[model samples]
Target: MLSDTSGGTSGFQWHVSGEGPTDNGVGSPQPEEEESASGVSDRRAKVTVIVLCYINLLNYMDRFTVAGVLPDIEQFFSISDGKSGLLQTVFICSYMFLAPLFGYLGDRCNRKSIMCVGIFFWSLVTLASSFIGKEHFWALLLTRGLVGVGEASYSTIAPTIIADLFVKETRTNMLSIFYFAIPVGSGMGYIVGSKVNDVAGDWHWALRVRLQHQTSHSECFFSELNVSLYFPLHFCCSPSFILSTFGFTTVAFVTGSLALWAPAFLFRAGVFTGEKQPCLKVPCDNSDSVIFGIITVVTGILGVASGVQASKKLRTRTSRADPLVCAAGLLLAAPFLYLSIMFAQASTVATYVFIFLGETFLSMNWAVVADMLLYVVIPTRRSTAEAFQIVLSHLLGDAISPYLIGVVSDSIKKSDSYMWEFRSLQMSLLLCSFVAVVGGAFFLATALFIEQDRHLAENYVPSGE
Candidate 1:
């Protein structure tokens, strides 16, 4: 008789030679044993996903919190626009550079342990940042860059775990839920940063407060998960990295610049009309942040939900569902982005409306694209693929965008006209619409190759098989 312990608490004994009796003198498993084994697997998968989603939520919240307080940081340091934007650029550069190493380790090591390390590292660095005095700006920048290293490990590995836990159709819905955190957390970052800054009277305190909240929450949840601590790490490095790079680069440029500067841009553009106070400690009217937060949270949730539903239905009829939906969303987003910028100076209400529409359309691709990647790549290679995508996307996209926009804005201000300064930012933002159009074209092209790639992935067999 052979003992099967794979079921953990519900282990059974089997007669491998087909001639011996089982543990209970029967040839088959007990009903209780079968139920216990299956139930444990199901429960474990659910718990794992919930924990990952929560972590992802905190991940993005930390990412954009600095952007939420960008104006205050600039003022505190007496930094120009380009310098302020370089903060984000530095973070992305570190993140992209470290992703490949993390990706390789994630594939071979215990991913749960890796995630715990990342969470702790970033949280510690974020807390350390709070102590950096105004004179130690470089120290603060270095901490921000370290936070990116921590984030890269978690972001590249978490989704692959999710992919392993679920099948295709169910995976789409689960991924939507997971990715919904991107916008929701981003919006919350704005609200939390602004509210904390208003109450604390310091940008450093604002960063510290948000980081503490996320860190505490993560610690509690990770403890409950009981991640394994022992594993040997191995390090590998994807073409989707190149193909997806182009589209995501364009998207990232717009999203990154907007996330970093939208509130400041609006404040300068006269949307807030609040009194300017000394020392940049003035609590600028938070209407723009609050409204933008609401737009992002609402539109992002609904867009991902709707996209999952649409993609699911379409997949039954066509192999091109994922990229097709992504292409259409990007195309639709382009016009709305243009209109949003056009109305920024004319009417605040119209601008908000267009932004809401544009965000909704643009968000449709997040879950679908992730799903496509999971299906197109084999399980063992998913981490490498994800890491490569992150490297390329950030390198070509957001890493340069904020600084580039700031550079453009500063150049336009050389004429020394406040109106032109405002116009310059407006024009710089308009570039996103054109980039969105290019991103959409890239997605449309992706539709042509995704079907074949997915088939190959699905049919792939191990060498021994």
Candidate 2:
């Protein structure tokens, strides 16, 4: 059931049965590694970091690509505000529920292979969106749901793999770099969507097309699943089951709603329309929409880069545990969010400032949380933790945001007024800000419990089996 806490110990014992070494014994190796003869751990950690970083990038790109082309999606399908919200809801819902299963598998299998399979499948889904016709609503929904399944596999496993590769103290830094892809990938997706739309006259086509893959799905998904499952069934016992479920459920609730309504609200607000005055004054045509999409893509990319850099520096000094830093980032982002919304009416410097700032703050949370998990959980337990995180964050964060906004917008005016739409989207920011504050508080509490070694013992098993 347990192992000793000496630094040189290998395998699962590094996490579970260790003593003398505090915080899951992650720090014990530092003093020994410096004096020892091998550089294997360091090299392994580097490779893991690089791989997961790429995974994070692809994950976000797949998610946001749809958002980038949302305006066209709404127009093509004649999707109502509520139904549009469902587009995001369906994907997130499937993701949130399935994450725990993937997390379980990651803990039991070859996480690397699982992640590769996920990326390959979701990329295909992204390519698939390119071919969907306007009336293929069911097909689109099904495809998006499948995309969720692919992401679920990757999201749960990657963090576990990273945790297995890195020690606690350095974990946050690596996680920050890896999670930085949320914004960068999202930015790239926007850029790609906008560029494709500019040339093809339809953004949906950009999202649905697929690229070539060298491997097969079963080989990827099952191999990882088997490795994790065959390792030990005991890891799935007790609190993990409950926690994983709760986490995934929370994420589905929040993110599902956010997907459907965020863009629709913006479109209604005339933000998507890129018009200055009130509604009906200028009927929105597909003619000029791509221009705003391009601006958004460029701004999002720059902001993501800036945020990633700032986060990297901040983590060096703050150990990525500073809730103050997280809080400050969100506070900084709020005004930009407001300004950007207002700026949708005008492409002024002020608008760009708001847009960029909003993205910067919005970008930090994932990396921060990812770092927290990589440091807190044992290597063998990381996949479960990550799966839990995905479930909770989305169920409570973005899953319901879009839908809530849509319902509220519909309630406020019950009319197709641009002013009402703008107001509705602006109001949703309040919720986003609130969630950020709550997340920051949780991070602060978690930090207090973190030992100098960078792992928390309240809920962890040593890495040794």
Tens-place lDDT per residue, model 2, 55-83, is 56656666766666666676677776667
TM-score of each: 0.87, 0.72
Question: After TM-score superposition, what is the CA distance of residue 195 in candidate 2 from its true location, in Å?
Answer: 1.7
In terms of TM-score, how similar is model 2 to the real structure?
0.72
What are the per-residue Cα lDDT tens digits for candidate 1 across 347-374?
8788889989998988887888788777
**Candidate 2 wrongly placed segments (more than 4 Å):** 1-48, 124-129, 168-170, 208-210, 213-320, 342-348, 428-430, 444-448, 451-465
Judged by whole-model lDDT over C-alpha atoms, candidate 2 comes out at 0.54
- Candidate with best TM-score: 1
lDDT minimum window of 10 residues, candidate 2: 221-230
Best by lDDT: 1
